[model samples]
Target chain A: MKKKILCVCLISVIYSLVFSACTKDVDFNQINDFEVSPVVESSLIFLNEPANKFYNNGVELTTFQDSVAIKIFKDKFIKDHLVKAELVFETSNSIDRGFNLRVDFLTDTNTLQHTFNFSVPASPTNSVLIYNYTEVFEGNELLSLLATEKLLFTLNLQPGEAINESTLGSIQLKSKGIFYLNIDNTL
Target chain B: MKKYLGFILYLACVIGFSQNKQILYGFSEIPQSLLQNPGGKVDNNWYFGIPLFSHIHANAGASGVSTYDLFADDGVDFNSKLESIVYDLKPNDFFTINQQHEIFSGGFAYGPSYNKNEYISFGLYQELDAIVYFPKDYAVLVYEGNQNNINRPFSLDHLNGVAELISVLHVGYNKKVNERFTFGVRGKIYSSIINLRSLNNNGTFITKPGDNNVYDHIFDLDLSLETSGLVNLTEKTDFEPNDLTKQILLGGNLGLGVDLGFTHQIDKQWYLDGSLLDIGFIRHSKNIESYELKGDYIFEGINPFFPEVGSGQTADEYWTEIEEEFEDLFTIDTVKTKYTTLRPIKLNASINYAFGEKLDKECDCTSEDSEYLNRVGLQLYAIKRPRLPQVALTAYYYRRLFNGLNIKATYTLDSYSFSNIGLGMSAQLGGLNFYIMADNFLEYNNIYDAQSVSLQLGFNYIFN
Candidate 1:
């Protein structure tokens, strides 16, 4: 009886030893290096303007400027995690006039923080001609973008073409921004 | 996402669950078997368990992934593996744990005639039960973002889980009705220490091409997260550390429950038994706190400022108005109303055919020849869960080595794995009874690879 009891105890001890080695070689500290980079896209601008809107009482307008309030940079989480951003501007011109477009980031008080300019060439036909432009923000530019609270868009008519109140067709601009974020839990 | 790793690991490793007590369900030699099936056979006329050491049980299981799948020191990059896991997440995947510690237990028989006697048993135990189903859509939205998932709605329905800690005080009555059938019932009183429930949520967030802008984001939400006994834990008073212990000892939100079971003898060799446990509910009235959010909104980019009807209102003014509207539409409301929670009910049934040399070679005409040294049977177990019922089926073989020793082995098939093999042993030495049982013994060599594991052991004193 004593021998049988001791055998049972010995088997239980051995089983406990096996249960202790339940896990294989695992690096729990690997969580320290874990990071997630998620890309988020949002609409930025959409403009569908008839040529008549570009004229003030039959006078051709050269400088068409507008500003939209943007408060994303005000968020500390967004400012810290955002690694880079790409602004995609797609333009369809049927106005027979080329235009230089300037997009700027402004502080809450309207102070200019960063600026990027591109050109939309004339369609040269009755049909709409589409042009694509992409601006990537990183490093100093990314930092500048994160310090602003507004978007200022300036569209200037080029010297080659002119439009009046009776002008036909329209100038269309559609844009979006794709933001890349690298979030670290430790931070 | 990285923050979920620690909690998930705790559920998969530190905690345990034993809804499928295949080895202990019909092990009549062990007194605790009565907890699983009250009508379970009893070998002793009376039994008493050692305090704290009577019955210690724990079982842990995860349906989809194991700890080694994420933390193994393989050549794969950790971030890449995490991304793959998030991509493969399923709503049906879940991790559950059930752990119990016995305080004191004892049972006795009483009657004028030995053949017509009935048994009464009682015990008190503290328990912790938790289950968390993988929220696949929520994880995907946070991991990969909605940029690549246009028009796809991220479901809040996947966010369903509950965890509770409580104490159970129970008394059971077992009676053999004639020679063919035995019926038993156990009444339970529950004292809740802590509870958290997040279930039956409905909401969705979708992104699509906007009529005016490049994209529009829409939100439709109806969600609630309820909790109890947490506020009592955080607030420090003169009671201090003793509060937790007090709650564990029945000084907390109380509830009532019952367990019903029966055993039938079909013939000399065939027998059947079944049990229904925890058919009760708990009313959480004290320290109750809950939060609910219900609203819907659509967001397209700020409309371009047109001077046609402007009262000289700046674009900033318009943006502020939209921001305030968004905030008003998504406000979270806190509720302090009391609520009720139904205990996770469990069902167990088995049919066994006994054949081999009988322990009692000579039986009188009035005695039922039930002493078979060998028995083989198939057992079915199921537990109610938030999303779906969890089920496990096991085939087992039992052998009584001698008058004082018994052993049982089992093979089980469940959602976790098909290779679950278990073993149990009980020994009676000079009126002292001891037993040890464990499932997934086949994975003992590579435990980290196993998706689920369970264990139960106890020591008791008996008198015939």
Candidate 2:
């Protein structure tokens, strides 16, 4: 009886050890129920005042000299496969003439990397008219721009016709960039 | 948005599921079995738990969605997966988390050896119990905006849960009145170190198309978060673990409780047992704090003419005014008030039939005095909850494989799953006793697919 009891004890211990070791390993794929998309937005406004005037013979507006910086793509996970970037310009013009708007993407040293331009029709009655324009960058161009930590944007507004000093017009430019990410499972 | 995502991840890590240990109920002669049924039969005179190594349990589960439901290898975008969770889940579906850890436990019985009818048993164990029910409505309101579900009222009735860290000191009396009836009653003194509860919340959030604006949102909220032994943490930035540990030992709230149980022999081959455990309440008076929000508000999109640039005011100023007005509408009131919380009472009943050969083959004792070596039984278990009592039914088989080795297998049906199989084993070698048990065995290979899973293991020293 003693020998039989000892054999049963040994068998039970072996069985428990084997059962515990057979459990499956945990992986990222097993817990991939949710995903996150981070979007960063920034806006810049230019007012036609004494410091920044509107010219009559289509003069290039130099008031948009300050560069806006992009800081959301610094994380390695986001910068590795940066998918898309969207730049939107909403202008509220009180002037009576149409104008041309130009935007530039530049480096820290002011080297132009990309440029986009669009035309905004003049307001019908100077009641703060709003015009919206959007530009999207994807694939290779987005990935290349995300390689750098710092981003610079420059904007210029060229009046189509001469304007009186008293006739004031303003442009509001908004930019929003969304980063899409896919994390791979190691196990 | 990033902050919300981080908070969700944090919640996922902290919340766990409740494990109903149906297999461990009346499984063997292990001293811990008495916790489930105070009148359970035991052949040993005394048992000593191995300090922290005794009675460790952990479980986690979801009733509405499993990990596979949200995080499978399917070719779907992350946003679409989240939308399905919000729209596809039923309103009654809930996520439950429960966990218990026994710090130290042991039991001993004493009486006249000649009188086999009466005995007195005493034991002390420190335990931590926590359970939280997921608020599905709140999750939907937070994840998906009210734009899609226009005019639909989202209720806050699902936000209910309780957590407690306490130690129990108990003494029980077991008496055999006759050849067919045995009864037991245990008196318990509970010393609770920490307690937190949120229940009976009533509120609604609705949004409808507005006449003057794009959308009009309405809120009617009445909710509170109450706590004890945690008010000091909010006042102090730095605290030592030793101080907190000392407080947990004796400086917290107190309460009383009792457990009643009985065992009856129907004949030479059948038996019945029933128990009601933890019928008690704790008075939370020490450092109590309650944060409540009760109010109603309506917001039609911010006035388009506010902070007019035409009047020389900036858009930033307009946004600041909106923020201030919103804060004024919903203000949280912090008060110090005493409250009471009842324990989640549990009930168990079982009927068994004994038939296999007795382990003590040489003993010439009658059927009434000698114990059977094998048994088959069915058990029913239920625990009180905020809305309703949760229940489970189980059928089990028990066998003695050898002189000191016993094993049990169980099949259970509960809210989480209809096919939950469990296994338990208790072995004794010399004076050392050890036991291990686990439930939902079919999901062991792919745990992520399972809605509920639990495991418990412990060690003790016993002598007959």
Candidate 3:
């Protein structure tokens, strides 16, 4: 009877071990649809420069001395990635004026540069007018600009023939950029 | 970005390969096998585990893609490889890591007339399990940005997973009521040291061309993250090893569970067995913290004309206003709440045919004629998950090589791999027993391409 009991016990133990060992079946492809939160956002402000220059007929507003140079440090989104930069130009004018706006991007030693030009329409009333221009920087152009720490933007506004001395308007050229950044959370 | 990628690579190195241990299933007469099914036909008078050296198991795996698929030196640039991974991945792909160790476990049985026909056993063990499914939609949106997938809503339902670490103390009872039937039941007390879970999340992200601006981005999110004992660690600047050790032992949360198993012998050759394990829940109340994000927000780009530029407003002030507007749109609520988490329950069933000569008796026992030297069997296993139950089927052969040696081999079919092969060996020297088991043997040579791999080994001293 003792021998029979021991044999049963041994068999029971072995069978149970077999069962436990065989039961762990993991399917890596069994999961679908997961969550990620808070996408990254990166922005660079260029010409939030304060200026009160009144423009007359054929008068040009130069931003050389009043131009702002902002330092953009290296970040995960700013390195080796394409940036969709949307530049917005804001001007507060008191009278109807046809103005020419010229923006220049100056890099290392002020040698490397890129330029963008826009024509602003005269407003019927004295109010702040906003103009938006979007450009995508990728490949060599993006890499070259990202390599430099400091970015300088020179804004020049020329009042067109629509404005005269009596209908003069004060223009403050403000430019800011918005870039959407991707945050990698694979970790 | 490099640091994040490096961390993922490091995780793969530490916990990336794992497979089911089909080889050890019914390989030999080891004492620990009783943990799998208390009603199994094997029983010893007493057994002592070799402290921390006994019963160490570790496994890690990825489902849809392997490391080589992304990082191999195939001349293709890194960007293309990443693009393929993000775009070509299936919705069901996932990554998981699991580990269990017997800190110190030993069990003894007492029964009628020393036959141990009806017996009681007990032991203790610690376990850690973690799993995270790959969110393909979110990956693509983050990798390429919403510029390409504009107007297409990306669902956030895929974000769900759990990570837990706990210690279990259990006591079991086995009874032989008739000539052909044996039944066992185990009651367990689970002391949970850490728990982190995020499940049932729902949200969507969409971007469309704006009428007033270049693009309009919208986010509809409802998500929550819950934690227990480890919540305090988030406030700490640095973590000390000793602090974690204390939590793992008896820090905070607790729960109860049970295991049931039975074996029925058919005539002289056939046997049937079934078991259900870890049917329980953990009540998390200590140091509890839950964070929830539940709202919708739309951003139509920024206006440089805001505050009228030279109206005595600094750039910092302008940007701060934008930040405040965003904060008000999608606010995160943090609260302390007690919650309960159910354990991932497991079920197993098997059938066995015993044959061949009676094995040599290593100890002085009364019933020597009842031992079988060889056996063949088929087993089915399943574990409950948040989405569905994971299942696997296995076929195995067990043989006693000699008086003190035994071996088992198995072939398994499961979700991760179709050709999973396993092997297990057990050797008894005097009264000391040592066993080692591994699965997915074919993938060991080229692990970078294999989806899963696992290993388990242990030592114990048993007496008849």
On TM-score, the leading prediction is 1
lDDT of 1 by residue, B14-117 (tens): 22234678999999889999999988776668999999989999989887788778888897888888988887768878888989999999998877664735
In model 3, the runs with Cα more than 4 Å from the true position are: A1-117, A120-187, B1-21, B73-79, B232-245, B302-321, B329-332, B359-370
Superposed on all Cα atoms, the candidates' RMSDs to the truth, in angstroms, are 6.1, 9.8, 10.6
lDDT of 2 at B74: 66
Best by DockQ: 1
Runs in model 1 lying further than 4 Å from the true structure = A1-23, A54-69, A96-100, A109-111, A122-126, A155-165, A185-187, B1-18, B234-239, B307-312, B358-370
User: lDDT scores for all predictions?
Assistant: 0.83, 0.67, 0.66
Relative to the unseen true structure, what is the C-alpha lDDT of residue B149 in candidate 3, on a scale of 0 to 100?
71
lDDT of 2 by residue, B1-464 (tens): 99998954543333222546776788646777777777766567777778877777777777767776666556666467766776676544556655566666666666567655665566666666665666777766555435346788888776877777787777777777777887888888887877888886888888765543434567788888898877667675666777666665666688889998888989988999999999998888988888898878765533222223356444445445544666765788888889988888888999999886554445654454556777999988878766666677788988776667888888877666767888888889898988888887766666677888777888888877
Worst 10 residues of 2 chain B by lDDT: B301-310
lDDT of 3 by residue, B144-209 (tens): 556457688888877878888898888888888787998989898888888888887898978765
Cα deviation in Å at residue A60, candidate 1? Answer: 6.5
Which residue pairs clash in candidate 1?
A22-B448, B16-B59, B16-B98, B17-B59, B17-B60, B17-B98
- Model 2 misplacement above 4 A: A1-14, A21-26, A29-33, A36-187, B1-19, B68-83, B86-88, B232-234, B302-325, B359-370
* Candidate 2 local lDDT, residue B165: 76
| CA displacement after TM-score superposition, residue B454 of candidate 2 (Å) | 2.0
